[model samples]
Target: MQSQQLWTVRWLNAIGDVDREQWDKLALPLSTPLLEWQWLHDLEASGSISPRYGWQPYHLTLWDHEELIGAAPFYLKSHSGGEFVFDHWLAQLASEYGIDYYPKLVGMSPATPSVGYRFLMAEGVDKQVLFRNMLSAIDNSCQQQQLSGCHFNFIDELWFAQFPAHDFASWKHQSYLWKNQDFEVFEDYLQTFKSSQRRNIIRERRSMSKQGITIRPLNGQEIGTDMAALMYRYYLNTNERFGPWAARFLNGDFFTRLFQNYRHRLLIIAAYTDSAAPPIALSMLLVKDGHLIGRYWGAETQVKDLHFNMCFYAPIEWAINNNIKTFDPGAGSPHKIARGFRAVANTSLHRLYDPRLKILFEQIIDQANDMESANIKALNQQLPFAKNTRPV
Candidate 1:
């Protein structure tokens, strides 16, 4: 057995440096699917995130003798492109203060916006002590390398409470989340909406039938390589339509690997002209621990309310059938409000090494959080649910 004083921190350039069993020993117990070894490894192996693309894997692992006790999936980010927490404004502020913000240490599941990012520690370990040690290691590395600071995005709310003791400040943001309030069926979900909005949802779902498109939910062994390839095409088409605003981080290879290795956690909602034909539209969701996360979706042809059907209604219905407790429809799209997704606060934590920058952020962060809270409150009010209706 090694002494606690002998704990060592090693920064890895690739996740493959650590054994998959060791990594999953920490990751498999997590509630979020994004942190699992298969997901992270696929992102790196597929070249979706690499130094050339501005995401350099710099994972941190803690060791005691031969025991791998803790790990944090980290990155040396050259630019903040896929990170959903908008920090371009902070980068500009750093520039004004003569700080080089690029290549900062970021801790999160790459390209995923849902929370549950925390340092993975072994069971029965002193988490607080380990957390402090990990933070110290990160701070030492940041200062030694002259990186601006470290940021942890979309942190697990429970773990987030532990950060203040370590001097990390919180930034508040909002995302749409659909909570299942013991809903047994799709109609039970619709009952939460007001009469007009409920009718609108029904009409939107019916539009798929009117266009001769049938939405099919396929999972597990049903998702084959060919279907995965088609989904990737739709993903690219969706991103291409947005041009500069596109967040197309994954490649075709990533989808192929995802289908092959991680299909058990995959749920594809496909819209086809008929059972004999290929899908014209597709929406992909990642499921784990009774939670469903909307990952990607796109349509080859234009159909009225097709996006709504594929992305929202179809997925929600499937989630209900599968007993999924919550559905995070991913980020952006105010239209999600009318579809029964409520505005929920998501948080990111920050710690700047420079005192000047830290002081500046402290001064403004509370006001920013307050404004965000107000926005969340206002948005929830606009949700097209009846006054007495609880979230479903």
Candidate 2:
């Protein structure tokens, strides 16, 4: 009998060294282009998430004698933007108590909230040892650099299941997720809702269509320079609409490389003005196999029901047309429930240094998860669905 032996921590400048095949090998959940080597590298290459913008990539990797064991996307964040969870209160508490919160470690897929975050490790390795060592590395770095605790947001249920004993707290959040049961057509989808809500969604689409706004679901290859440029404009406009976190992640070049490298996984659905098909609103999503992910969307002009048509209806139609399975419209907005997205549990894992803070956040999040589960049940009951016709 013996210990698995000593481990070493390393940093990856390029995702190439991280072995995509191995990542896929250890991967338990569905992968996205955003989490892939090419996409993450493009983000760094195109200056999306970098130290220059306060997101220093300090990706910690654990190797058990030269074989990659555990790794997580660790970023030294100056500010929180792409992170969907709001932690200003924690930061403010840190500030009010004269503590520094910036430069905290974040374990998440940057600029995207498609959950499935965990420190990917091989099966033979001791999960506890692997995570402890990984956390040990980050803790040392935090102490040396005078930073705050780690925040792991938007992860999966499996990771959450195994984290509590490690003093890691669970953060609960509700997001939109549509299941593709036996649905084969758009009408089949409409059949789930009560007639009134169904009529509203139908009328919403009709109004946008009658307004002469045509939505074209374009793949990355089919995306022209004009539409790409318009997307950036919309990104800018959306940023203004929201405030801080809305700032663009990648400058235009990232998208340029994006459109070039991983064109197949992308679906840019564009809505345009009739004068010459100039786009007014658009959505950018990643499509894999039979799943259509709702990524980013924005409009140049504020048209009524435009967001509904372009973001939800258009993609759902495409999903039905292609027979795609699940549609994960990215996190936020409870309004998504009425639009056909169901209550789905999204998970994330965390580790903290101060035992008191660890206990506090743990209790807080445990209570929160309980409350959220109950609330979602209540929300489900309120959905406009005929008796026994609900899509659960």
Candidate 3:
């Protein structure tokens, strides 16, 4: 056996240029992010999504002599804001410590935070070997560029056991999900809730229905370019009203192209006024395989319980109807619990290059994990249901 120089990293603006069959073969199991070829290509083709906007595509590939053994969806980020796990504080602290933090390296499924970000390895290749070599390459890239630290956000379980050796930082980010365990219907799932909470849900839906707020679920093909702009407008309006920090990672054209190509994997639940010709509030979700993930939502005008109804309940109800295995109602909201979205732990591993910072973050992570675990336990105990009531 000849030990040849193997594994290299190459960036592709469009997956179209890559060998589609081979890439998808490895991409499928490496992450649970999404399986939409057209959507990702849309992001690249749009040009709005680039290092120009603080996100530069950096795809890491591992080769054995002459063959492709692994690949990771990565980026060179100018800031750490959009990953959904707040590292602005870390960036601030880094500045105080006189460390360059911006323009850092990232290993993630750019703009999406649904976990499962790691290098995709081809069959017959030992994953551990690929990870080690890939880390060395990543370190080399960072060092040559003299950039700050690297982050693997919302990482996959496979990377957790291996990332430590690579000196990556491990951060515990907050994520919650609702699971379906043979739940036959929405009603069956509702039975797990307390009577009061169940009644509240019933009332929210009934109120929306009474006000002629009916929801329509659309896919990529069903969603047109106009709706894409409308969605972005609403997204911006909501962001403005809420906070500047609530801004989305993508632009209008990205959504338009996304719906055009990857409609099969999309599940958009739009809320329309009964008497109106079209939707007034739009909620977009991604349905790939057996999982339903709520991504974004916005309304032109605020309606009573509109956010909860459109964002959480409607999409979740659809997930139940569609027999989805899990529902991630995007980012955060304690109100998710009131709507039956339960607390669940998500793993995010990191590697800090600086030894002193590493020691400090290690201690912080220990406390953070403990706090998260206890909080989850408390959340479960505080379920609106009576103490004697058993979850279905």
Candidate 4:
């Protein structure tokens, strides 16, 4: 009989500790740019995600002797602000039952709501076996550390399907997603909308031109230092303007580092009034493969319809022109439906260490998921697409 090879499991406190090439070898094959080595490294190196802000990097890596084979980016989070899955209700439920909820282990790209989170396994490996071993490690860690639970947010559908649901409860959440329907041009996109809304979109776009504001994409290398600095300023100002509700998890340093090192995945949609004037508004997005994910945006000056244009319309147009397949225009804003983005169900998996909490979650999860599914259906029914051109 052949002896089984034992996998070496290592808990890393920082992603930077891993060689960039090795990390990218696993991450680059994935559809999401947010999970790439440099992106996570910038979040840590910039101090944007750190213990001071309630996010402590606690990545899980598996080694096959001298070779790197598998990894999962995780955070020991003290609060649930940036996860975007909104488990405060669960926390509150746990509190009612005398369960501690903070200091939970979270798996996701910090502050990013884009989906497709999964363990990065090397090629030619038994992925199911790797997943089982990784889960065992995580369960043991949670018990050893007295953590309340482990939560994986915005999981990819493929991963979700094969996920061992016996170990964790599935929670459904909805996000605004726009899928390309093979429209060749921007106007072709508008044609998908109902007549009235189509006219409204045209008016909203033309309103910017009438205001002497031109929106353009500054992709990859075009996002130089000055524009990056401007973006950081706008991000800060935008967060401050939102008062207590702001999701201001990132800092100026994060933007600076990303612009310097991760420009290849960045796209900035900027609005300008004149040839020499600085951009009045800007929205930043991450592009990887055929997926476009909206991240942050801010404006130095208020302009009519600038928010809709810079954040949605112009980006959608650019996505079409660049042959991008899908767009997740960040989070919130139910108004995205009127502009053609449909509400799609996104998932998060949860496992509570306490037996009582686990029972409670299991008891209510099915009903909760059904309600959420119904909510997604209700939201999508409100899409402004023409009756004859329903989105598939």
- Model 2 agreement with the true structure over 279-344: per-residue lDDT tens digits: 888788898867778877788878999888878888988888888888999866777888888877
Q: Is candidate 1 or candidate 2 better by lDDT?
A: 1
**Poorest stretch of ten by lDDT in candidate 1:** 157-166
What is the full ranking by lDDT, best candidate first? 1, 4, 2, 3
Q: Write the per-residue lDDT of candidate 1 for residues 1-392, one digit (tens) a residue.
A: 35569998999999988889988999888889888889999999999988889999999999987788989999999999899989898889989989888889999999999888999988877888888889889999999998888999999978757656877888999999999888899999999889999999998888878878888999999987688789899999999988999999999999998989999889999888878878898899999989999999988967899989888898899989989999999987799999989999999989888888888889999999999999999998899888889644
* Candidate 4 lDDT tens digits, 173-276: 98989999987999989999889999999999999989988888988778877777889999988898889999998888899888898889999998888969
Question: Which residues of candidate 1, in runs, are more than 4 Å off?
Answer: none
lDDT by residue for model 3 (186-298), tens:
78767777788889888887898788788777775777656777887777777777675575667778777766666777787788776356579888888776888788788
- Taken over the whole model, the C-alpha lDDT of each candidate is 0.89, 0.75, 0.72, 0.89
Off by over 4 Å in 4: 1-4, 163-166
Off by over 4 Å in 3: 1-6, 11-19, 29-37, 64-67, 162-167, 220-226, 274-276, 386-392
Candidate 2: regions farther than 4 A off: 1-7, 13-29, 64-67, 122-132, 143-146, 159-165, 243-248, 273-278
